[model samples]
Target: MSASSTPAPQAEGQRRTRRRTLALCALPVVLLLVVALFAPLPYSLAQPGETANVLGRRDGKPVIAVEGAQAQGRDKGRLMSVTIAATQPEATVRLPDVVRSWFREDRAVMPREAVYPGGGDTKDAEKRISEEMKDSQHKAVTAALRQLHRSPKDIHVKLRLGDVGGPSAGLFFALGIVDKLDGDGAGGGLTGGRTVAGTGTIDADGKVGAVGGVPLKTQAARRDGATFFLLPKSQCGEASAELPSGLRLVPVGSLQGALDALKGIRTHGKVPSC
Candidate 1:
């Protein structure tokens, strides 16, 4: 080939070579970002029925039972019941606004960042979505507070936990802690005024889960004097058989449903005002 032709071919080859080089350099970075954005966080790892209280005993007996309740039809969920025998029997808990608000947004669980810089024409959308997730979680927690605050006379609580990503239980967990601090005494609303305790998640719409760790939670509630335990309907049959004496299992669907179910309860000769 002529010298001129040689130069032209060489130029074309160089251009193609540069393009390939640039693409090669960019590939690893894209892969790295994919991994970084999609990789799970250490703390994000979770297991089903892992966080429940599974001590397996009630009142020094090898058998401890908790109940779960659920109603058939739309807009209804579930409730939880527990029995336990413990030293600090008298306690009541209330739900706080912040905690309830977290569930209102429908994102009960948050895993690690999955895809960063995704669906964004610019980089700002990623950050915005992250912030929005945080805000929604906060609001869900707030909604919970509104429900628990409605009944300040009853405290010792029962709750049920569910599958992974079911952090809605966190809100109920907070309320349970509060009950431990404030027993039935007056202004806080958490009545039943006895040493009763339980566990279940609080949603904006007030749905409970048929959770695991029943044996443990039931023992905890009975130990605390929870004469009546709220449970989801689905679990009552299986859970009730394991309950000890002095504990009755009540099934409920939503939080409102549980409240309605409580209408018949006479805590201490006087009906509770919840």
Candidate 2:
């Protein structure tokens, strides 16, 4: 209205113009940050993966079956083997995904090389994993036979699972074989009608070996309704990092140890734990 009032409104308009300009000037920087956040990194994101019951059927067939032996418990309670769903070595991982996964208790971020040892050649990585899976299966059969004091040449065991590859299934593979053959040694199923899960590598000597990504596998087990986990004694600490509710860890270092623990669980006897 007055000249003074006119100057005040003019100044206010100028201030608004400057603020808008500043925001416009900062837009590129914000966009750059967003782009960087979404850009690919050399890491892999992982979470709970698939679970298979060793003592049960998949696709209408036995997961673990033994020939030329008095097999038992093919329909017994579940012996679940857990896996992780991880970004493959060939897949792209973003920074923002990594940052968010870092704070998540149920998730994991892994070095791409760790998931695939040679890194860039995804085909080679997959081949290696497949080879490891085959080797683990062979070793599991040998270990199970040895545990039962049976000769490998005289016995035949078959293991099958679709598209899953890793040595981590060795422990469960062996257990499943043992369950089908011997069970709990008292005419009872090894799992005692309870759902159990685990992951570990195994040697022909029956020694259980550590498999990385225990936390993720543990989560997978819990998600698949497993109440007991057969843990490699060495992975006790890792499995405890984000243990799920109602899941129990049974620490085992050998096939015999795992059998004993399962027996204890079935009979409500004392069992060693992590």
Q: How far is 146's C-alpha from truth in model 1 (Å)?
A: 4.9
Runs of candidate 2 with Cα error greater than 4 angstroms are: 1-39
RMSD of each: 17.8, 4.4
How does candidate 2 fare on TM-score?
0.85
lDDT of 1: 0.40
Q: Tell me the TM-score of model 1.
A: 0.36
Model 2, 238-269: lDDT tens digits are: 89878999999999999889889988888899
- lDDT of model 1 at position 5: 34
List model 1 lDDT by residue over 113-154, tens digit each. 322223332235435644543443343344444554633233
lDDT of each: 0.40, 0.87
Worst 10 residues of 2 by lDDT: 1-10
Clash pairs for candidate 2: none
